[model samples]
Target: MGSEKQGFIWLSGLLFLNIFVLSTADVHYYEFSLQESPFTKLCSTKIILTLNGSFPGPEIRVRRGDTVFVNVHNQGNHAVSLKWEGVKGSIDGSNELIQPGRNFTYKIELKDEIGTLRWHATSAWAAATVHGAFVILPVATEDYPFPAPTSDQTIILGEWFREELTEANQTITPGSADAYTINGHPGETYGCSNDTTFEMQVDYEGLYLVGVINAVANETMVFDIENHRLTIVGQNGTYTNRSFTNSLTLAPGQVIDVLLLPNQNVGHYYITARSSSGTHITNGILRYTTTTTSF
Candidate 1:
């Protein structure tokens, strides 16, 4: 009897281990680097911050309800802060501080909603670097509430400054706009420039979603996707009836997802974002490259 009991216990342990392994295999993992780099001409010196050595670190794409694990490496001299601006008040929520030379892991069980999201830094020095987007899609066979496209892509918008945010904010008077960035960098370096190219192919006529994140403090942003009809999907990742037809006005921390209908006579188009207040200009290109492609 004792031998039989031990055998049963061992079998159960193995079964549990198998289950754990299978579950782990189902989830996806992504890693990113946080370093410092340059942004502009006026602030032509080196400013340190957490990023993938550039502005707008990287956009991570995953499925709804899929588990995500992010390994954060802090290469800076000071501690880093990571904040998630997804579903509120949960593990995916924002505002976390990560120490320097150390690594931390973040696990998020994505909700069953498909949209664009952002991971921002909560540290004082992190206002510039340590930012990126996450594009979450629905499961296969699931239909999007908006029109479907032959292919889709993500575009991240930001304002890049040459100096540290702390110094910029202090030197510039309050209620003044002094930020710079588009996509992820100020001068179009690191793929954040207003001239970076974006290409995609569409089936017939359909809607394409473009995500815009306003990372600055108080400036209102305006975006122009040349020759395309645009409709606002959601603000800050939440659905809203307050949709704009052509241009969008975005304040800091606001996210705008736009549904675009492309023109058949497409060669290459420039999707541009600028502060409605004339602060900065950032741009991305949308080109009709192929028939069926995934981004």
Candidate 2:
């Protein structure tokens, strides 16, 4: 009887291991190219190095335990290399530096990372523009530990310099920025000539999962939604001991996941990102849809 029980336990362990292994063995492929493109922010337009002509590049999404292959082609004038923010690179030495007009393939295994992370250039000043969100979703068969939100949104907060990025980096003194931006828009509230701003529409009583990325080059930022509380869910691809806060601080290259349960009265609220040093403050709008007529 003792021998039979031990054998049963071993078989059950093996079966569980097989299921876990199978859940994360998928492979994904992507291609990114660096090119010079005109990006306008803070009422000025300049040519900057971008991935595939996107200022914040493109989001790379995969399931946990999946393998990802990214072919990075450097068509711009500067050397480039990508460093996955929280992922381990291939064991076969796939991630290497790519010179101007050269290409290199990056292989990453999302062994255990699952949450909001990012990828950016390791070269100088390129990270200011050549970066994008990297999301490792939970396995299809697995459910979230908590109740899933109604929707998910990605918000990238970054600093903007009016001059050329490389030149600005060399000349920027302590505590300075031309503007702060949310999803590449330095919203109209900042007095910029352009009226571009990041806006999200929310239905009454719906919950939202917000993935916030602090991609600022220099200063730490505080994110807050006026008159609303946020529940901390995860950061850097890992779940955290859930907590609630009215505001949260994020340093450069940090990502945070928060759950926003809009229980306030139906109206518009300002979602603000302000630098800790008081150098800049930017605003976006959260508009709630209402069914009743205003008084």
Candidate 3:
């Protein structure tokens, strides 16, 4: 994908993409510092656990058959464990809890599996914000089953809480999210967020691969661009027969790869994400290269 930036989780659906060139498979190394960071959203500021202080943590990209070793240092107050979704369960202690001030190294074997996958804290409380993308490129002899995109982007779908969700665990039931986000912003739909809204621009009639991950704690969200349609091309770790639809609905921790064509009139389009029930809503902007008007 082009850029997932460093902020934003997918509000409803991820909307764009690309893949990495393959090379000889080898071992890759990474480090993660799990700590608490404060963020202000939906008119409230709260401390949440984050990896290296970034929400939607850093993305891990690799080729199939490569091995990965991630060194995780737990600096936050809580114990946590991480899992590479869609892959075999955590390996070499990656699934074991990293207690506060302790460290652990994870070994991952990226076998023949391909496509977009995700990683997140296995703890219910810490999972609220600790996660990122895992992309596996096919080896030297393989290519995507569909058209290569002219451009690429990633959308991370996630929920936001005004209070520390972990703190709410003391209650009989945890609270629902206050707002959904795309790329970390609520997209001008909530209080104090006009300037923080997330947006994406596209070339008229350009073909785009949109990588999307639903990191929401416990909600299924629907994503779409007003008056536009997308073709579902891949999901989890498998590419499938192309299916066309206007919106994407994803459950928590689910991921999907879709192709989008901005073939409508040149202007700003609302990239809308909402609960499947349509009760809660948020948005991002999808504008054309020469866009000058909005409705």
Pick the TM-score winner: 2
Error of 3 at 164 (Å): 1.7
- Higher-scoring candidate on TM-score, 1 or 3: 3
Q: Is candidate 2 or candidate 3 better by TM-score?
A: 2
lDDT for model 1, on a 0 to 1 scale? Answer: 0.63
Candidate 2 per-residue lDDT over residues 166-272, each given as its tens digit? 62353334356688888887887667666588888888778888889988867788999999999999998887878999998998778999999877788899999
The TM-score of predicted model 1 comes to 0.72
Q: Top lDDT: which candidate number?
A: 2
Cα lDDT computed for each candidate against the true fold: 0.63, 0.81, 0.79
Error of 3 at 287 (Å): 2.0
Better of 1 and 2 by lDDT: 2
Candidate 1 structure quality by residue, lDDT tens digits, 1-295: 9999999999999787545543533478877767665544433555657567765677788765577888888777666667777744367423465667788888876654457777777753466556788777755555666666545556565554444565334233223434455664443433423333334455435556777777665566776767777777666655555365767777667777777776546476766677676655655566664344348
Minimal lDDT window, size 10, model 2: 166-175
Looking at model 1, report the run of 10 residues with the lowest lDDT sum: 167-176
Point out where model 3 deviates above 4 Å.
Answer: 1-23, 167-175, 193-195, 290-295
